[model samples]
Target: MIIDYSEQLIVQEVAPRDGLQIEPTWVETADKIALIDQLSHAGFSRIEAGSFVSPKAIPALRDGEQVFAGIRRRTGVIYVALVPNRKGAERALAAKADELNLVMSASQTHNRANMRMSCEASLAAFGDIVALARDVGGVTLNGTVATAFGCPFEGRIEEDRVMRLIDQYLDLGLDGITLADTTGMANPRQVDRMIMRALHRLTPASLTLHFHNTRGLGLANVLAAYEAGARRFDAALGGLGGCPFAPGASGNICTEDLVNLCDEMGIPTGIDLPLLIELSRTLPALLGHDVPGQVMKAGRNCDVHPVPEYVRGL
Candidate 1:
C-alpha cells in the first residue's frame, strides 16, 4: 500500500475526553482546561474538550460543564464534545461546543453495555441528536462506530455491520464518522483492508480512525490506515483512556508518537512534536501515574548530545 504525502491529515486530540476518562483521581477542572489550551497552542485544529455524558456513568468527567466553560477559545481551534443523547447534545450546545460527537458500538453487546441502549435505539437517537445540533447553528455532528474491530464481549465484528452503521451515520447528515477499535483488537492487515474498503465507499473527509494501544499495535495500525488513505485520526496526549465497558482495553494511540511518525515520514499533520511532548509530560503529575507513550519516555529520534571535552581530547 502507498501513502500520499501530498495530502494533509487531520488529528483530533481526545486527551481531555477519551484520555482522562479512565483515571481514578478526577482531573481538576482547571487542569483539564489548561491541557486543552496547551493542546490548542500546540496547533491541533480540533480538540475534544469534554463530554456531556452522565456524571454517574463517567464520574471522572463529572465536571464536564465547568471544564467546557473554562477553556480559552482559540481562533482556529474547534472544540468538540461527546454527547450520548439529545440531553447531552443540549448540554453541549449550551456550553457553546463547536461540534457534537455521538458514539455507537459496532458490536451489539458492547453497544447495549456502553450506552444502556440497543444498537437500533442508538441509531434512532443519532438522528435526533443530529437534528439537535442543527437546531443550534454553530454545532457540527460527528458519529463514531466503536468496536469497529474485534470486541471483547462479541469477538470479531463483521465488516458488513460496520458498513451498515457508517451508511446510517451518513443518512443522519452527520458531518464526520470515526471507526474506533475500542478493544484494541485491530491488526495492521485488518486496518488496511477495512480502511481501504471504507475509503472506496466514503469520502476522505467523512472518515476518521480511532485506535487503541491495548496490544501495542496502535501505531502500526495507524500506518496501515494512513497507507489506505485515511487522513483523520483520533489520539490522546499521553496514551490515556480506554472503554470502561471493554475490560482489559488500554489507552488510545499516543499523540506525540503519532505526530513523530507522521513528521519522520514527511506527513504534514500540522502538530508540533516538541510542544506535544511538553504537554504530555504534565500527565504524570496531573493524573498521578506514569503514561505509556514511547516518545514521551525516550526523546525524539533526532535528539542529540554535544561531544564531551574529555572524549574530544582522547
Candidate 2:
C-alpha cells in the first residue's frame, strides 16, 4: 500500500525517562536538563523529560522535579513526566509538567513485576491520577499500555485485553493512550492489524506507538503502523532504554535512526537531523559507553564522500 506523503508525524522523545531509567551511571541533573533543552530546540512538540517515581525504584531519574524545574521551556514544547501512582502524579503536577504519562502492562505478570501491583490495583491508582488531573485542569494525561505486543513473561496477550485497556483509559478521561512494545516482540503483520483496529477507535492525534528494537523489528513495525495511518511515535535518543523488569528486552528505537528513516521515506518528523546527530554523538561521552544509533556514526544518506586519491589519479 502507498503512504500518504503529506502527513507530518509526531515523535516524542522518551530518552530522559525511559532511556536513563536503568543506567548504571548517574546522569547529572544538569545534563538531563541540557539534554531536554537541546531536544526542545530540535522541533519536538513533546518530550518525556523524566519520571516521578520512587528513587528506590529508579535512582537514575530521581531528580525528576529538578529536571522539570530546570529545563528551558520553549514555547509550544510540551515537557512530559511519567508518573506511576497518585503520589508520583502529585509530584509531576507540582513540577508543572505539561503532560503526565501513566503506564501499565497488558500482561498481569508484567504489570505485577513492573508496577509492583495487580492490574486492578494499578487501574485504581490510575483512577485517582485521572481525577487529580481533571481537577488540576491543565496537564494532559496519557495512559500507556506497556507490552501491548507479546509479553515476554506471559506471551501472546489477548487483543481483548489491549482493547479493554484503551476503553478503560478513555472512560477515566485520559487524553490519549500509547501502545508500547515493551520487549520488542511485535512483528509487522501483528502491528498492522493492531494499528488498524486502534485507529478505528482513537484518532491519530490520541494514539501513539512506542516500540523497542530488541528483535530488530522496531522500524518495520513503525512503517507498518504509519502505513496504517498511525502518526505519533515514542523513541529514545541513542536507543537507550530497556525494561528493568522484562527479561531479554533491549533499548527503545533510536530517535536518529527513526528520523533518518522518515527522512528517506519523505515523511516529515519536524526534527532537525543534524542537531539530533550532534546531540547523539555527545551521548557516548556522557554515558561512558557506545550507543546503538547508526545514523550518527555513519552520517545521513545525503552526506557526500570524497573520491579516493588512487581513483583520482586514474
Candidate 3:
C-alpha cells in the first residue's frame, strides 16, 4: 500500500499519568509539577498531566489534584487528565484540565479488573461523564479503547468490537479516540491492518495510537500506523508506564525514541528532541532508577565521536 510520508504527526506525552501511575515509588508533588513544566517547554501540543481516579486505587499518583494545580500552565499546550467516571470528570473540570480522557478495555475480563465493572457499566459512566464535560463548557472529551489490540487474560480481541467502540465513541460526541495496545501485543502488520480500517471510520484528527515496548515492537507499530495515514500517537517519557491491572504489561513507547525515529525518517513531529532527552535524563535521578529511552542514553544518530590520538597516528 502507498504511504504518506509528508504529514506532521502528533505525539501526546502521557508520562505524567500513565507512566507514573504504576511506579512503586511516590514521586514528590513538587518534582511531578516540575517534570510537567519542563515537558511543556519541549513543544508538546498535548500532555497527559495526571488522573482523577481514587487515590486508594493508584496511590502512587494520589496527589493528582495537587500535581495539576501546581503545574505552570503554558499556552498552546493542552493538559489532559484521565477521568474514570462522573466524579473524576467533575474533579478534572474543577482542576481546569483542558481535556478529559475516559477509558474502557476491549476485553471484558480486563475491563472488570482494570475498571472494576463491566463494559456496559463503563459506557454508561462515560455517557454521564461526557454530559458533564459538555455542561462544564470549554473542556474536551476523549475516549480510550484500552486493550484494543490484545488482552493478557482473554488473548485476541475481535477487530469488529474495536470498530464498534469507535462508532460508539463518535455517537457519544467525544472529540478523540485512543486505541491502546495496553500490553504491547501488537505487531507491525497488525497495526497497519487495524489502523487502516480505523482511519476509514474516523478522521485522523480524532484517532491516537498508544503502544507499549513490552515486546520491543512499539516503534515498529508506530511506523506502521504512520505509514497507514494515522498521525496521532501516545508516548511516555523514558517509556515509564504500564497497566497496573493488566498482568505482565510493560511501559508505553518512549517519547524521545519516537521523536528521534521521526527525525531520522524526515517526518516532522514538532517536538524538541534534545530538550526531551535532557528531561529524560532527569528521570533516573527523580525516580531513582534508569529509564527505557534509548535516545536519552545513546544520544541521537547524528551525534559524532572524537577520534583517539593513537588512531590518528596510525
Candidate 4:
C-alpha cells in the first residue's frame, strides 16, 4: 500500500499508566502527578494518565484517581485512563478522564488469562461500560486490542480475528482503536498487513499502535505501520512498561526513540525531544534502577563526540 509521506504522526505517551503498572517498586501518587505534568508540558496531545483497575491486579497503579486529580491539566492535551469494566469506567468518569481506554486481548487464551473472563464475556461487559460512558456524556472511549500481533500462550494471532475485534470496537461506538503488540511478536510484514487492513475500516486518526520492545522490533514495527498509513502510536517514557499477565513481554516502545525517529525522518510529532530525554533520565532515580530507553545513553545524532586525545595532540 502506498503511504502519504507528508502526513504528521500523533504520539500518545503512556508511561504514567502502562510504564508504571508493572514496576516492582511503588511510584507515589505525587511522582505520577509530577510525571504527567511534565509530559503534558512536553506537548503530547494524549497521555494515558492512569488505569482504574483492581488494586489487587495492578498494585503499582492503585493511585489512579489521585494522580489524575492532582495533575495540572494542560489545554489541548487529553488525559486518558484505562478502564477494565463498568466499575473502572465509573471511577474514570468520576475522575473526569478525557477518554477511557478499554482493553481486551484478541487471543482467547490471553483474554482468559489477563481478564479472567471469556472473550464473549469481556465484550459483553465492555458494552455496559460504553453505555455508562454515553450516559456520562463527556468522556470518550478508546478500545485497545491486546495481543493483536501474537500471544505468548497462543502463539500467532490471526489477522481476521483482529479485524473482527476492530469491528466490535466500532460497533460499540468507540472513538478510537489501538492495536497492541502485547508480547513484541509483530514483524514488519505482519504490522504492514494488519495496519493496511485496519486503515481500510477506520481513519488514520482513529487508530493507534502500541508496541513492546521484548524482541527489539518495536521501532521497526512502528515504521512499517507508518508506511501502511497509521499515524498514531503509543509509547512509554524511558521504555518503562511490560505486561505482568503477558508472559515474556518487555517494556513499551521508547517515547524518545520514536520521537527521535520521526524528528530525523522530517515527520512532525509536536513533541519536545530534549524535555522527553530529561524525563527519561529521571526514571532510574525514581524507580531505583536503569530504564530500557537508548537515547539517554547514546546522545542524539547531532551530539558530537569529543576527538581522541592522540588526534587532538596531532
Residues 1-314, model 2: lDDT tens digits: 65586799899999999999988999999999999999999999999999999999888999998899899999999989999999999999999999999999999999988998998999999999988988997899999999999888889989888999999989888898999999989999999999988988899999999999997899999999988889999999999998765666669999999999999889998999999999999999999998888889999988889999999899
- True-vs-predicted CA distance for residue 267, candidate 4, Å: 1.1
- Per residue, candidate 3 scores C-alpha lDDT tens digits across 90-138 of 9999999999999999999999989999999999999999888888899
What global local distance difference test value does model 2 have?
0.92
| RMSD, one per candidate, in order | 1.6, 1.0, 1.3, 1.4
Q: Number of clashing pairs, model 2?
A: 0
* Backbone collisions counted per model: 0, 0, 0, 0
lDDT of 3: 0.92
Q: Which candidate leads in TM-score?
A: 2
Q: What is the lDDT of residue 137 in candidate 4?
A: 89
lDDT of 1 by residue, 70-118 (tens): 8999999999999999899899999999999999999888888889999
Clashing pairs for predicted structure model 2, backbone only: none
Each prediction's Cα lDDT score? 0.89, 0.92, 0.92, 0.92
Model 1 quality (TM-score): 0.95
TM-score of 4: 0.97
